[model samples]
Target chain A: MTVPAEAARRRIVDLFLSSEERLLQRWTQLSGASPGELRDLYQALRTALSSEDGDFADVRGLLAELSRARVRQGHTPSDTARLVFSLKEALYEVAEADGGPEALRGFVWFSRLVDDLGLYTFESYTAAREKIIIDQTEQLLELSTPVVKLWEGIVAVPLVGTLDSARTQVVMEKLLQTLVDTGSEHAVIDITGVPAVDTQVAQHLLKTVVAARLMGAECVISGIRPQIAHTIVTLGIEFGDIVTKASLADALSYALSRSGVEITGAARTRVAVRAERA
Target chain B: MERVPILKLGDILIVSIQIDLDDQSVLALQEDLADMVVSSGARGVIIDITAVEIVDSFIGRMFSTIAAMTRMLDAETVVVGMRPAVAITLVELGLSLGGVRTALNLEKGVAMLEHVRGAAG
Candidate 1:
């Protein structure tokens, strides 16, 4: 620890104590941190400066914790970083008290330390936010690929969003496991919620369908909108004898028939009544 | 010699693989299955693999080979009750086991062979 002169230490401490209220108010306004939080953070910083270690570990640790809390509280990275840098304002007034070359060198040293701390807080804030984003993405992937039993011998997987390889693997495993558990013979994959279907998405669908076939359950892919149909044709992608339908209802009926359940009476009467009306 | 038993259930030949197949056992089974199909005059073959766990490319290829050979002997082949993990490994290993019919269980497999025979006749 490079001991600053006793006069300089007393001057810095006195300046920090006098401007404590203003510093706290500034940090709270900038980071949306409560006044109580600012007081605890300032208290830690004061102890770090006065302690024999002189490493500022306590102050850095407090700033890291504050950075994570501010990130979770929806504060922007720049705002969170400002909370650390704002403390330098009170320290700068103390640095300005000495006009000699030695005092100027000491101020520069302290400024560099504070700058590094501010940069550390910014990095921690971004890292914390990135972790939150990745966690939510994984959760959304799981939530989007749900396997539902539509009938006694049929299961349906309704997929939304872009079909990436990771998502397709999850979809395949979940659908295949459900098929085994329920002993269902047919699986209908409805992509009605998918925003757009490209060649990669088509390949993912094919891989999933082929995997399901290997597990002994036939797959029916439904929900081909007009634009997707146009894209499929334009890309010259071959689905190769796989049954496809424009809607989930058509796929359900096809699956029902494949399972030997004839949808006979009500549908037939409706058709007959429509013909009679015509 | 560890021989995988091939049981005769009426007109259908049931080959339930209860052990992990080595190269020699697999070959012997293939030769035996072909001979049995010819001697018993079975119309269908159901190879149940529910008890077996690991299926490398060799096993996967053997399945394809058996299915093809059975077809030549005027018999349909249905591989039944494949575990989910085995299926995944097979697919990841790029073995589709194409031209082989699969069923969820032995009962469905037999029923499928019957349905195929009935449709053919």
Candidate 2:
């Protein structure tokens, strides 16, 4: 196959050799270095880079093939994860060096690779890498377009998608930082916004709530859709063990209730009765 | 850069924010997003960054302002799709994001709005 565009091809050769040498050494230590495995890794690298035929599908298909090939060839799940990670780590410098969206386009293949592996292998490592890109991309725009600082009470943050360690760390930090700055006593994360539920993401949600709670701001999760609930159940993710709700409103209402704030409409009678006793 | 309205997700509206939010754009866009939120009766707002690169402090402050106003209006706001280096730089610079809500992506921000809509008034 024709080599990648001049710059990308150069990057591949420069980075791939060190990685290959390391992989060969590792393999040699693990068993005996087979020339075929070494050659296969080289081809795998080439295939991954070459798959981008000015058409996006090429790299994606290559990732799928490499994942299966890695597994069938007895490369541990972690091995494949590292392969993806190293590619990113290598490209991370490339993007930083080049500094443009064009630089980031190469990453799409890696992103697709993460999705491909995340679905097939069901590994946390792959998920974490995906979160890195997502988090970075999310951080680019000021989501606070309609920004506000609450002088008091709770403001909810709904977290969705796979909350890998990198993302979980950001989620916990940003939410707590917001609560502190706003002086809000409650920060709710409604999972109903989440399209998928896995044990890792669920735990990160739990951790976020716990972190908020530690700051004296109670965290409430709402919007547990039926499908998400089922996935949580199958995945053995236990929200019953943590503080969560079925919907964002419930979570907000729960927060309001916890803060001793009464919604004046339906609870007017109860408020009157309590006032009378007081 | 010119700003364009793309899609609506409940009270949360997505704006394809054009031009990097620098000092000048931040001033205008703050008023722009706030007015839109109020007029649209959106409980939340997301500034899509698929095209943006840099978010200087002046613009960062605008985000904080919009977030504060949205809270006053009883709505939430989320900033979506920032680059990694941008995030790192913002954090390292001891940036003042104020009380703005941040989401990982557009879909999550929209989904968060549903929770806000469903809650008891």
RMSD per candidate (Å) reads 5.9, 20.3
Top candidate by TM-score: 1
Give the alpha-carbon lDDT of every model: 0.81, 0.58
For model 1, how big is the CA root-mean-square deviation? 5.9
Give Cα distance to truth, residue B25, candidate 1, Å.
Answer: 6.7
lDDT of 2 by residue, A146-248 (tens): 2233214667666655545556556656766666556565777765556776676667666555444423346666787898778878987656546767777
Worst 10 residues of 2 chain A by lDDT: A142-151
Candidate 1 per-residue lDDT, tens place, B1-121, comes to 6999999999999999998778999999999999999999999999999888988988888989999999999999999888777887777678989899999889889989998998999
User: What TM-scores do the predictions have?
Assistant: 0.75, 0.32
- How well does chain A score by TM in each candidate? 0.78, 0.43
Clashing pairs in 1: none
Docking class of 2: incorrect
Where does candidate 1 stray beyond 4 Å?
A1-35, A43-61, A98-103, A159-169, A192-195, A266-278, B1-56, B69-76, B83-93, B114-121
lDDT of 2 at A85: 46
lDDT of 2: 0.58
Error of model 1, residue A46, in angstroms = 5.3
Winning candidate number (lDDT)? 1
TM-score of the second chain in candidate 1 = 0.98
